[model samples]
Target: MKKKIWVNIAFQVGALVLALLSTTLLLLAAGAPPFQAYAAILKGAFGSAGSLETLLITWSPLLLTTAGVLITFSAGLWNIGVEGQMAMGAIFTTWMLRLLQETSLPPALTIVLGILAGIVGGALWAGLAGALKTFGGVNEIFGGLGLNFVSTALTIYLVFGPWKRPGVGSMSGTEPFDRSLWLPTLPDTELSLWSLTLSLLALVIIIVLLRGTHFGLRLKAVGKNPKSAFLMGVPTWQYSMLAFLLCGALVGLAGAIQVTGVYHRLLPNISSGYGFLGLLVSMLVNYQAVWVAPVAFFFAAVNVGSIQLQLMYKLDSSFSGVMQSLLVLLVLLGEGARQRFLRKH
Candidate 1:
């Protein structure tokens, strides 16, 4: 067992090295100094209090999304519609805030209601995908993708039609809410302690749920073999739907934070690709809840850090994405190789 553990660690380290080596070659090809570029990223992510603040802000939503995806992944569900679910969440939150902004209710209560509405919206969207899979024989992947498109279209329509700003609607999104409705943030930063705390709490809850619960064991059984799990009397479809609802709720919180804590308004691309990114994070960690927080934070740091590459080297911020994709690909390949090696030995 110890040897196997060491082997696992070695392969992980090897994958990390390969990823960095590939990223270096790519940077060199791009006429950028690899070491300096890396240094700049490190500095940009941690160089100042402000940078750390931005990193934390980015980290919070990522934590939420990653935590959410962990649940669906465990249930053997693709849940690609997470993006749409997030959009619905933001839409619902924005709508709720707008409806109550002028009401006699306190802003704090209004914000809580908006967040709750976001959670409901996300669950409803995910429930649609789950129902299609459970009852309509539609694969979750296709159903999710289709729902994502619909959600995007709905967001566009709302931003351009009913929820349009005064005079004319622009892609910039709806008019901003009053400051009183905003989530409380640390002084001089967009990092909302409320959002951050909630995100961390969600992560902890998911970790405990997945690691120490009979539900998790059954869910894993369902994922590994649905027919077998059903034979064992597990209600596979119901569990699957429950997974979808739970995941959507968590990620919906991410969308809610994006609105109340960060953007302060509904906007196009409000999910910020965090849903897809969360998928990558889940893949990278092999859906192990324990690793989600650190991996998500690393991704967040890379994202925040890559801004320096664009500013200093005239490089596109997508360089960070390239690095991330490479990392995930190599790690997965390494895992496969390790398994093959073990079998051979």
Candidate 2:
């Protein structure tokens, strides 16, 4: 076991080195100094107190989304509709906030309700996908993709129609929520300590649940061999559904955090591809709960640092995305190589 662990770590480190080398080559091709660009990235991500705060803010939702992805992946489910689920969550959170923005309810209570609504919204969206897979014989991937489009359209319609800013609504999004509806942020920064705390707590809970629970073991068995697990009396279908629901709830919470803790409004692209990004994080970490947070933080830093690349090098921020894709590709290739080596030996 220890040998396997060390081998895994070595492969990851080698993959990182290769990824960086590939990214450097790309930078050179684009007429930029690779070292300088890397320096700027680090600076943008952590050079200042404000930048560090922003990094933490970005990390919060990312950690939550990735944790959710980890759960579904462990259950052998492809929950690609996390994007839609997140959008639904944001929509639900906004709906609750809009309805109660003018009420006499305490801010804390109102925010809690809004968050819960977000969770329900996400769970419902994910549940639909799970039902289609289990009962309708539809592939989760296709169903999820279709649902994602529908959710995006719905968000656009709401933003440009009934929920549009007072009048003459553009695609910008709905009007910002009342200040009182916003999540409480740390002093002198846009970072929401409440959201961050919740994210950390959720991570701890997930780690415990996945590593130390019978339900998690059953889910793993279902993923590894549903027929065998069923023969052993494990309710494979039920456990699969539970995994989907749990994933949806966490992702939905991420969406709610984005709305209340960051954007303060429901936008057409409110999800901002964090769902997809979270998928990458989950894959890179091999679904280990212990590695999710650090991987999330690294990705968040890359994302935040890309802004500096755009500003200083006049480079397209998509370069950061390229680096991310390369990292995942290299990691996958390295894993494959490691397996082949073990098989040959």
Candidate 3:
């Protein structure tokens, strides 16, 4: 077991090195100094207190989304509709805030209610996909993809129609929520400590649930071999749906945070591809609960850091996407090679 752990660590490090080298070559080919670009990246992500705060803000949603993805992956379920779920969450959060903007309720309580609504919204969307897979005999991947399109269309319609900024029906999204609806940020920074704390709390709960609970063990059994697990009396379907529920809720929380704590409004592409990025993080960490946060933070840093590359070297921010894709590819290849080597030995 220790040998396997060491091997995994070594492979992860090797993958990072290879990814950096590849990114460096790409930078050189683009006629930019690789080292200087890298330096700028670090500077953008961590040079100032404000930049560090931005890094933490980015890390918050990533931690939530990746942790949620880990849950579904552990259940052998591919929840490809996380993007839709997140969108739904944002929509619901915005709706709640808009509806109660003039209410007499305390702002804190109103915010809590809005967050809950977001979670419900996300769960409903995820549940629809899960139902299609479990009962309608549709593959989750296809069902999820379809739902994602529907969600996107729905959001666009709302933004352009009823929720459109007064008489200016642009895709910019609904008018910003009342300032009272906004989540409290850290002093002198746009970073919300509430969101960060919530993310950390969620991580702890997820780790504990997945590693130390009977339900978790059952889910693992179902994932490993559903037929065998069923023979052993595990209700595979129920557990799978439960995973979807919990995962959706977590992702929804992230969306709610993004709305209230970050963007402060519903917008087109509010998810910002974080759902898909979370999928990659889950894959890179092999869906291990313990590794999810660190990997997520690293990816978030890469994202936040890429801005400097864009500004300093006139490089496209998509370069970060390229780096991320390369890293995932290399990590997957390394995992396969390790498995092959172990089998041979």
Candidate 4:
């Protein structure tokens, strides 16, 4: 176990170094000093209180949504549909807001409704994959991938049709949510305290559930050896569905938090592809909950800091995403190599 962990760590470090090198190459292409660009990237990520705030703002959603992915991954399910689930979550919450637009309820209560609505939306989207895998005899990867397009189309439809803001472009969305329904902000910080707390609580709950429960053990078994588990009388399909539902709910929570805490309004492109970026984080950390925190924060830093890199060294801001993707690919390749080397010995 120790050896395996060390291997994972080594691969993680190697991938990070390669990511940095890739960024440096981009800097050189732009006729800038690579070292200076690197330093500036670091400085922008953590150089001041303002930078820290920006990092946290980005970190909030990444952390929550990645943790959601970690849940299904633990059960050996690839829920690539988190993007759609998140979109549905936003759709549900926004619709809830619109429905109650005329209600004179307290902002707190309406906020709760929006959050719950998001949870339901996400769970429903994720549930479709579970259903397909269980009854339709479909592979989850393709099912989830297909669902993402559907959800994106649904989001666009809502914005352009029923949810269109009055007198605005037909391709746009509804009026901004009520100010009272906004998520409370952390004192002296752009971060949302409620959202952060919910994510932290989710991390703790998932850790305990996965590490200390019979259900977790069975879930692990289903992932490691599905046939064997089924022969042993474990209801693999049921457990898999359970996993999908949990993943959906968590992803939905992420969407709800995004709208309430950060956006305060819906957009067709509201997601920023954070759900996709989260997949890279999960793989990089080897699905370890503790490691997800830092890995996500670092990714968020790079994402936010890349703006400075663009300005200082003429680097394209897209460099950060390319770096993240490369890191995930390298880690997987390195792991495969290590396993092959062991088999040879």
Instruction: Compute the lDDT of residue 217 as modeled in candidate 2.
Output: 89
* Candidate topping TM-score: 1
Over all chains combined, what TM-score does candidate 2 have? Answer: 0.97
| Residues 1-345 of candidate 3: C-alpha lDDT, one tens digit per residue | 898899888987998899899999999999999999988888898888888898999999889888888888988989999999999898899889888888899999999999999899888888888889889998889998999899899888888888899888776778888778889986778988999999989988999998999988998898889999999999989888888888889988988998999988889888888999999999998888898888888888889999999988889999889999899999999888878887796
For candidate 4, the 10 contiguous residues with the lowest summed lDDT are 167-176
Give the winner by lDDT: 1
- All candidates: TM-score: 0.98, 0.97, 0.97, 0.93
The residue pairs that clash in candidate 2, if any, are none
lDDT of each: 0.93, 0.92, 0.89, 0.83
Model 3 weakest lDDT span, ten residues long: 169-178
How far out, in Å, is residue 86 in model 2? 0.6
Tens-place lDDT digits, model 2, residues 270-334:
89888999999998888899999898999999999999999998999998789888999899999
- Tens-place lDDT digits, model 4, residues 224-335: 8889999999998898999999889988888888788888777787667888888889988878877888889999998987789788766788978877787788778877
**Residue 15 of model 4: what lDDT?**
66
| TM-score, cand. 4 vs. native | 0.93
Q: lDDT by residue for model 1 over 193-304, one digit each (tens)?
A: 9999999999999998898999988888888899999999999999999999999999888899899989999998899889999999999999999998899989999999
List CA RMSD, all candidates. 1.0, 1.3, 1.4, 2.1
